[model samples]
Target: MGTREIGLPQRVPGTGLPARVTIWEVGPRDGLQNEKAIVPVAVKLEFLDRLAEAGLTTLEATSFVSPKWVPQLADAEELLAGLNKREGVRYPVLVPNERGLKRALEAGCPDIAIFGSATETFAQRNLNSGLEKQFEMFEPVLAGANGLNVRAYLSMCFGDPWEGPVPAEQVVRVGKRLLELGCTQLSLGDTIGVATVGQVEGLLAAFADAGVPADKLAVHFHDTYGQALANTVAALRCGVSTVDSSAGGLGGCPYAESATGNLATEDLLWTLEGLGIEHGVDLDALVKTSAWMAEQLGRPSPSRVVRALAG
Candidate 1:
C-alpha cells in the first residue's frame, strides 16, 4: 500500500494527546493464534489484504513458534509466502526463540516480535520458563534479528491469571531489559484485561521515571472488564502514541480462560476519531472487513462499534 496521510486535526491547547497515533493491527497473529479452530491460509491472506485495504499499516502477520504450542497458526510459513506484501506496510512475525528467528529469517521476514511476561507465574506457564530464563531465551533471537525491526511484547503487565497484581517496579525492570536487549519498541500488554486507569497511569509513570520514552512504547489492552478504552485513553494521555488492537475483537488469552477479546480496532478507531486524533484508518471499511471475517469464523463480531455500524 502506498503511504497516505489522513489530515490531522489541529492540536488543542492543554490536550495531552499526540497529533497522530499508530494503531498496530494484531488480528492475524495475536488475534487468531489462540482460536480453537485453525484458520485456512487463504482466508488468512484475505484477512490481511482487507486490513491493508482499510489502511492498517502495521500488522502482526504470524508467529514462527512450534505448532504444537499454537496449532491455530501452524501455517505461518505458508501464510508469509502467500502474503501480498504492500509498500510502506509492515508485516511483523512473532519469533519465540532462535529457532523461530531462523525460520522467520529463512522466510524473508523483515520484522519480528518477541513476547515476555511481567509476572513469574505467567512466564512459567506461558513460556515454560522462569522470568529470567525467558529473557535469556530472547537474547539470541534479538541478537539474530540484525537489520530487522524487533518488537518486544511484555504480557501480563498489570495482573496475572496465576498471580494477582504485578508490581510496577517489575514491569519497568523487565521492560527496560527488553529495550536494552535491542527491541526497537516495547508493547506493554494487559493480557487478562484487568488493568485499571490508575494502574495504567502508575506503570507509565514508572516507565517514564526509568527513562524509557513513551515514543518507544505501545499499549495493548483487552476488554475483559470493559476497561480497554479507558486504559487506552490513559496511555494516550501519558504520551504513548502507539496502540495494539485486533479487528472485530477477535482474540482471547488462551492461558487465561477468564480473559475476553482484545480491544477492537473499530472501537479504538471510534475513540480516536471522537478525540480528533489522526489514525488514517477508515472505520466503515474496517468494520465491514471485520464483519466479513467474523462470518468466516462462524460468529458475529464481539466489537460494539462493529455491531453498531454493521447494523
Candidate 2:
C-alpha cells in the first residue's frame, strides 16, 4: 500500500504536516546518565548549546539524583548554572524525590520530571520500593513541584524483562494516579523497546477509557527491538503528539540489563518529515550535533540518519 492509503497526511504547499509534533530531546540527561566515563561540564554545556541551535525546544537537562547512584550527572547543579538558558526552550531536570526536588529548586530549575514504574519488579529495581511505597515516595515530590512544570514518566508500560507483557489496565491505573498527583504530563515508556503497534494502540485505548487525554501523554520508546519508529507511528495515529528521543540514539536503562539506546531524535525527525509533520527542528543541524557528540564519546552514532547524512 501507499503512504496515503495508510491515512498519514501528505505535504501541502508552503506548509508542513497537519499535526505539529513535539520532540522532547532527552540526550543530555537520559542519554548520558549511564556512561561510566564522566563527561566534562564544558563539553556537556556545549552539547546542550548545539541542541538548542538545532531548534530543539524541549530538552532534558540533567538529573538531581544522588551522585553515588549516577555519578555522570553529579555536576547537575553546575550544568544548570552554566547553561545559556535560551528563551522559548525548556530544560527539565529529573528529580527522584523530595530531596532531589529540593536540590533542583535550589539550583533554580523551572521544570522537573519524576519517574514511576508500572510493574512491581521494575519499581523495586529502579526506585528501590514496592508499588505503593513508590507512590508514597512521589507524593512529597509532586507536592513540592507547585510552581514548576512537572512531567511524570511511567516505565515498562509495554513489557518488562523480568515480567513479560504488562497489562494495559495496570499502566492506565498508574498513569491516572500520576496525573491526579498533579503531573502536567505523563510519558509512557517502553523501557525495553519491546512494544509493538498493537500494544501501543491497546495502551492508548486504555488511557482513553480512563479519561486520560492524548494531549496529557507522551511516548518514550527505546530502539532495542527495532520497533520504536513503528510504535511512534501508531502513537501519532492515536493522537499522541509528544515523543521522547535521544540524539545519536544515546541512552540505556542502567537498571534494565536488556535495555538499549533510545529512539534516535534524528531518525524520529526523518520520519516526521516524511509524514509532513510540522516540527521546527533543523534535521541537518541535529545530525551534525549527534555526530559531534559521538566523537566526544569516542564512537560513531547509532542513529541511522546520522550515518546516512555523514556518508
Candidate 3:
C-alpha cells in the first residue's frame, strides 16, 4: 500500500541454513478473504487438500467471522466440518470474538486465532473498539479457548495504518499481554506492509530485551511494498523461525489503501531454498497450487517463483 524502496544487499554465497521451517499457509483464510468473486466451498476444500499434500504442516483453513463482514467465508463452519482432518496436521481458524469461537467449536476446529490491532484507529475501525476494549473482548475469547483446550494465535503486532509507526514498546506490551491471555504464539504482522528491516530489527530487539524469546514469536508479512521477504529474513536472523504466509499472495487490508497482498507462500519458499533452509513443502507443488488459484481468480500470480515456474 505504501511505496517503499528496498535495495537488497546480496547475502554471502552458500550460507548453510536451517534444515526445516514451518509454513502456516493462510491462503484459504487470509488469501481469499478479499476476493471479489465468491469461492465455492468445494473448491476451497480441494485447495486445502492440495496444500496438505504439498507438505504444509499448519494450514489456516477458514475464518468464523460474520457473513456480513466477510461473505466469502460465510460457510466457515460447513467448510471446517467437511475438511478431512489429517493426523498431526493443524488447522487453525481465525476467530474474531466469542461468537466466532463458538461457531468454530461447533465446526470441530481445535485451534482458533484472535486478531487485535496495534493502533487505536484501526482497532476502532476494524474491531469497533479501542485498544483496551479490544483486549477486553479477547478476555472472554481467551477464557473460552482455555476451557475448551484450544490454541489461540494473536495478529497485528508489527505495523498499523491508523497510527503511523507504532512504537516497539507498544508492540512488546501487546505481545506480552496476549501471551498472558493464553495465546500460544504471537504473530507480529506488518499490517499495512510498511515495516522496514531496521524497524523489524528494532522491534525484535525490544522484544528480546523484554524477555520475550523469539521461539514464541512468528512473523506475518505483507508484500505490498515488496519487502515482506526482507522483513521475514530479518525476523529469521533474530531467531524467529515460524512464519505466516498465504498462497498466491491473496488478501489485503481493507482499511489500508494500496496494500497488495500478504507475502506469497511461493516467495517464502524461494527465500528458504536460496538460504538452504529446509522446509517440508514441495516447491513445485506449491507453484502449481498458486498458479491454479490465480487462474481460478483470473488474476496474475503474485508469486514471482510461480510466474517463473509457469514460464
Candidate 4:
C-alpha cells in the first residue's frame, strides 16, 4: 500500500511560542548514518529530494566523516553530487575536522556542521580529542569555513552516559566557545534522550545568562526516554525557534550506546501545527516520504505520527 492521507490537527494557537520555527531536518545525514546496511547513493539522493519536496528548508544532506568511521555515509560525496539541491532549501553536511572541511570545500559545500561533546569522555570517544583539544581541532575547520553557513552541535548537554548529568554552566561555557569560533548556530544536543523539561529550561536560562541569545541556539533531542517533544516545547517556550530532528524517528548516536532515535520530524510538525506555529513543513508529504523510507529500510517507521497516519 502507498502512503495514506492523514488529517491535520486542530489549531490551538499556543501562547508564548515563536510565530515560526525552523526545523533542521537531519534524516539524511544523521538518520541514515545509523543504518546497518549501506543505502545506495541514488537512494540517498532520492531521499534528500523527497525531503526538500516535503517543504523542509534545511535538510542535512550528508556528513564528511571518514568512511572507516561511518561507512553508511561513505557515499556522501556521491550523494551530494547527484542531489537536485532545491533553491530555497539549505543542504548542510557534517564536517568533522579540517580534513572533512577540505573535502566539503572541494565539493563546493554551501553549509556545514561540526560535532562536539559536552563531556570529556564523549569528546575522546567521538572526536578522538579531549574537551580542550576538541576546540583546537575545530579551529582550522572554522577558519576554513570562510563565511559559509556553519553550525556547531554540542552533544550530551542534558545528560551523559558516562559522565551523568552535565552542568548548565558547562554547556553554556563550551557552547559559547563554539560560537566564538564563528559558528553561526549552536545546537544543544540531548544525545541520550535523558533531558527533562526542567533541564531544558535551566540550560536555556543559563545560556541566556551567559550572554548567548536564544536566536543563536537550537535544540536537538533524542526520544529514547519519550521526552523529546516535551523538551522541545520547553525549549520553544524559552524562545528557541530552531529545532533539530530526524525524519521518521530515524537516528541515533553511533558513539553513544544509550542514544536512541532522534525527535521525529513528523511528530514535531504535528505539535507545531496544533500550536499554531509556522514550521513550513507539509506534514502529509513528510509522512509519506518517511513511509517510503521505512519501506526502503525494510521496517516500520518509529514516528508515532507516521505509524498512526501513514502506516
- The regions of model 2 sitting more than 4 angstroms off are 1-18, 254-259
Better of 2 and 3 by TM-score: 2
Model 1 earns a TM-score of 0.94
Write down the lDDT of every candidate, Cα atoms only: 0.90, 0.88, 0.80, 0.91
Tell me the lDDT of model 1 at 248: 92
* Candidate 4 Cα misplacement greater than 4 A, ranges: 254-259
Cα lDDT over the full model 1: 0.90
TM-score of each: 0.94, 0.93, 0.91, 0.98
Q: CA lDDT of 186 in candidate 1? A: 98
Any runs in candidate 3 off by more than 4 Å, and if so which? 1-19, 147-158
Best by lDDT: 4
Q: What is the descending lDDT order?
A: 4, 1, 2, 3
lDDT of 2 at 158: 96
Residues forming the 10-long window of minimal summed lDDT in candidate 4:
251-260
lDDT of 1 by residue, 265-291 (tens): 988988888788889988777888888
True lDDT of residue 83, candidate 1: 94
lDDT of 2 by residue, 12-46 (tens): 42232237899999999999997889999999999
Per-model tally of clashing residue pairs: 1, 1, 3, 0
